[model samples]
Target: MASQVDHRYIERLFRAYYSGEVAEKIFHSAPEPEKREWAFLRLDGPMVRHVKLTSIDDLHSQLDPPPKGIYYSLSTYEYPDYPMPDKQRIKTDVAFDLDADHIRGAVLQEVSRCKSCGWIGEGDVCRECGGEVRKIQLVDDRTIKSISGEVSRLLDRLANYLDVDIDRLRIFFSGLRGYHIHLEEEPYRSLDSVERIELKDFLTLDGVEIHHAKEPDSAIIRILEECRDVLSEVEDVSVRQVLESLVNSKDNPRHFTSIRKRLGEDRVLRERVSRTVRELCGVNIDPVVVTDMSRLIRAPYSLHGKSSLIKTPLDMEALEALDPPVIALASPSNNMVKVHVDYVPHLIWGGREIPSIHDEDVILPEPLAIYLVNMGLAQGLRHV
Candidate 1:
C-alpha cells in the first residue's frame, strides 16, 4: 500500500529552504533574470506562470510561501510576464533532456504491496488477503549510470561533430531520473523551431539513411566496429564474415562500396546495421524538449516536489562522480525523523545497505525520511 505523504512536514521544509543560502544561489545562477519567465508550482494549488522578477530580493519576496517546484524559461523575452502571443522572443538556448525512462537498457526497481492487509511483497495480489496491490518505481544506481553514459555521449557529439563550444554548456541533474544540457552559445541560441528539429534529428540519427549510399558513412563504420557482438548473431555465415571484415577494416575507405552492396542485398543485415547505428552511436533524448523554444527547465538548486532532491548544477567531473545518496544529503536537514514504512526496496543510502522493510517504524535522517514520505514508501511520524 502507498503511504500518505506528510504535506505539512514537506511544506515546512520548503519554506525554510527558500529563506536560506540555496535560494540566493538560485537567483544568482539564473541567466538574464529580467528577460526570463518564471513559474512556480504551489504546494496546495495550481502552477503560477508568467512571473517576472528583477532581483534577488524580488525572488525572496515572491517565494514567501515556498513552492513545490520552480522553473525558468529557456528563451529570453521582451515582455516575459505577458501571455505567449504577446511575449516577444529575443533568443532561446538549445537544450536537451536525457532521461533514464528514455534510455534503452535502463532498469527501474518495482515494489508491490497490498492495501487491505498491509502486506508488503511482489505481484498483483497480496498473499495474506488477496487484496489489490499497488506498484511503486524506485531509482537505482544502474539507471543513473546508464543515463550518465548518454549524457557523456551527447557532450562528445556536441563538441566534436556539431562544433559547439564546451564553455557555453550548462549541465544539471534534473532532480529526478535525468540530466539537462543547455547550450547558450551563439548560432545555436538563434536557431528556430524548425532548425532545432533538424539538430534533434542529427543527434538522434532519426531518419538516417544507411543503405543505398555511395559510400559507408561514419555512423555505419562506427556501428560495424562497436557492435560486432550484435552483428555476429547474423544467421548467414557469409554475411557475418563480411561484417567482421568490415569491422577489421573500418578505417579503410576503399572497402566501403563492396560492403554496402553486400549488406544492401541482405535485408536482415541492412536492418541490423541500421538498428545498431541508432542504438550504439545516437543519443537518446526527448525530441519534444529539443524542439520546444519556450520550454521551462527546473530552476537550479530548487527542490523537486516528487523526489525531495535538488536540481543540482554539474560540471563534467561532478556528473561523472554523481552519487544520489550523497546528493540527497544536500536537502536542508540536521536532525532525524521517525517514519512508518509500508514497503521500500533494498536501497543503499548514506553508504549503508538498507534492507527491504515491511510495516516497520524506522528512525532515519531527515532527508531520507522526507524522501520516503515524498516517494509514497513511508508515512512520517515525528521529528526524533
Candidate 2:
C-alpha cells in the first residue's frame, strides 16, 4: 500500500507544477489523444494508463492530481485518430538517452527485492535468498561526470558527423542517470524513422569500418588520439611501442588500413583498441528512444518521483561542474526528518559524505529524506 506522505508529496509537486511555466510549455500543442493515440502518465503501482487532453486548460485540469511522470507521444498523426506510420506521419525531435551503465568507477545505488522470498537487499541481488531481483539504482556524481563527457562526444558527432547546428541541441538531466540531448531544429525534427536510424548509426558508430575506402580524416585523428590515450595508460613497453609505431604512421587512409590490419592480427591488442574506441566514441543510447516515434520521454523540468529530482535543463558550457545533489534540490525547507534505513553503504549529501547507519534512524533534510525514502534506503517517519 502507498503511504500517505508519499501520496501527498506527489500531490504537492502537482500543485507546484500547475502554478509553474513548464506545464504550459509541455502541452503547448494542445494535444488531443483519440482512439489509438493517447498521452501517458505514471501514477502509482498497477497504474499505467493514458488520458485524452483536448486543450491546454484541459491539461491543467487533468493534472490537478499530478502524476509521478508525464510523457506525450512522439508520433503525431494527421487525423489524430491513430498512430499508423503510413498516415502522413509528422515530426519527432532527434533525441538520445545516455545511461550510467557505461560510466566506470561510479557507485550506483541498488535496492533489490527477491521474487521468491520477498527479501530486500542492496546491490543487484538478495544476499540471503539468492533469488531473482528487481533493482532500483540511483545515479551518483561520478555517473553525472561520466555521462556529461558522453554528451559532449555526442554534441561533437551531431556537428561533425550529421552536420547539425550546436545551437539546436538542448541537454537535460534524466532526473536519474545520464542526460537527454534533444535536437529541436528544422531538418532534424522532420527526419523520418529511416533517416533517424541512420543518425543513430552515426552516433553509435555501428558498422563503421576503419578502412582506407570509408574512413574519414577526422575519424582517423580520433582513432590515433584514442590509441595514444590508451597506450599512455599501459605499463607494457612492448605494447606501447607497437601502438606508437602504428599511430605515428602517415596521416592517410592506407596508414589507417595498416593500423587496422596490425591491430586485428593480435587478439589482445585488438580488444584493447576496440575498448578504447568504444569508450571514446560509443554512446550508451537507448535505441528505442530514437527509433520508435511513438515512444514517450520524461518531460523536461518535471519531477522524477522516484528520486524527487527535477528533470532540469542544463547548460552545456558548464557540464563538468554539474552537481547532482544541488540539481536534485527543489525544496527550500531545511526541516530534518529521522529515517529508518534498511541498508546503504554510504550517503552523499551537500556534495560530501555524511554519517549513516544501516537499520538505524538517521535525520536528514526534507529533500534528502525524500530521496532516501524513494531509493528504498530509508523510510521517513511522519512525525519526525
**Highest TM-score scorer:** 1
How well is each residue in 1-384 modelled by candidate 1, as lDDT tens digits? 123358877777788888787767887667787899999998876899999988888788778788988889989999999998899999997888988888876766778768887677777788989899888767655556557878877887788667897767998877767788878888988998888988888788776656555444565455446456666566666656666766665566677667777777888777766665666557899888888988998888888887666777777777777654434434455667888987777865544567888889997766667767766678855777
Candidate 2: C-alpha lDDT: 0.61
Clashes of 2: 0
**Which pairs, if any, clash in model 1?**
none
Per-candidate TM equals: 0.86, 0.77
Q: After superposition, which runs of candidate 2 have C-alpha atoms over 4 Å from their true positions?
A: 1-5, 12-22, 28-38, 46-54, 80-88, 102-107, 110-136, 212-227, 231-246, 252-254, 260-276, 323-336, 350-352, 380-384
Off by over 4 Å in 1: 1-5, 114-119, 124-134, 212-214, 217-220, 223-254, 262-272, 323-330
Model 1 vs truth, CA RMSD: 3.4
Instruction: Name the lDDT of candidate 1.
Output: 0.75
lDDT of 2 by residue, 1-384 (tens): 335776565467456655676666656522233311344354554434344456567567656567777655555556444435544556666678887865544457666767787676665667877778877675555557656766776777678656788875777777766787777677877888788787776666555433322443456445445436556765656555545655665466566567667766777766554455454445657767888877666766666666656676677555657654434443334456666776655556445565545677777655566666776666744536
How well does candidate 2 score on lDDT at residue 259? 66
